[model samples]
Target: MMTIRRRKTRKRRSPQKKRSRRRRSTKRGSQVKRRRRQAMTHRKKRRVKRRKKEIQTRRKRTLKEKVKLLVINLKMILLLKLKKELRVPQKTRQLQKNQPQKSQQLKNLPLLSQLPKNLPLKQTRFQQQKLRPTKSKPLFLLAKPRPQHRLQPQ
Candidate 1:
């Protein structure tokens, strides 16, 4: 009987096999890297959006506060102006209330019994004359000589 020997099978590979395998692996690595970069960029964008929202809310709050303050200030100013306008009437009414009725009645007594009304009438006439517009001379006219100055030596 002859001795039988087992033969080892050789592994077979094409020339382009290594290059194709390397290209496929490189493509997968690049895809993974791109996904990671995109995820980072997305997170950054979300953070920026959140910050912008916060800033917008803050601005809105500040604007509302300013408007509220403006309204309050306007109300206060109106109240002060109204109070000022009211003061004169209030003082006049108070003065009217404080006057003595007897004194007022005395003024309406007979002309002989009452004090002379000439001074008050004169004052009122003066006031009326002051209120009236006086006839103004034209600015270009020369003045006439007075009689007293004419009598005097030149």
Candidate 2:
């Protein structure tokens, strides 16, 4: 069964109510701005923290690699020193046997000095000296033997 009832009629709001609503809406705009500012600050802080962590990790990796290279260089220097120390006695013993022959050659030096010199060609006088051996050694092999002939790694 359907019962028919008379509907309640709408009443018009007062001017004060409309004014209060406008006031609340204006206040809400400022509140929205404050919330957005807080969110922006939080995001910036998080990004800065992330960047710091990445930089620290990079520094650690670089430090580890540097330590490894330093260790390798030290090992190479130690090995070179050990090899030179062991080989020195053997070389001195060999030089003992060659002394007589070297003295004979030294005696013949006077006769060789009497030979006529070749005339210089189109090149400069000092230019041919570049092909001669040098006494300098590399910085890394400072503890190596004197007059290093050839320290080829076996």
Worst 10 residues of 2 by lDDT: 137-146
What's the CA error at residue 3 for candidate 1, in Å? 50
Which pairs in model 2 have colliding backbones? none
Question: After superposition, which runs of candidate 1 have C-alpha atoms over 4 Å from their true positions?
Answer: 1-28, 90-154
Assess candidate 1 and give its TM-score to the true structure: 0.39
lDDT of 2: 0.68
**CA lDDT of each candidate?**
0.68, 0.68
> How much does candidate 2 score in TM-score?
0.47
* Model 2 lDDT at residue 44: 100
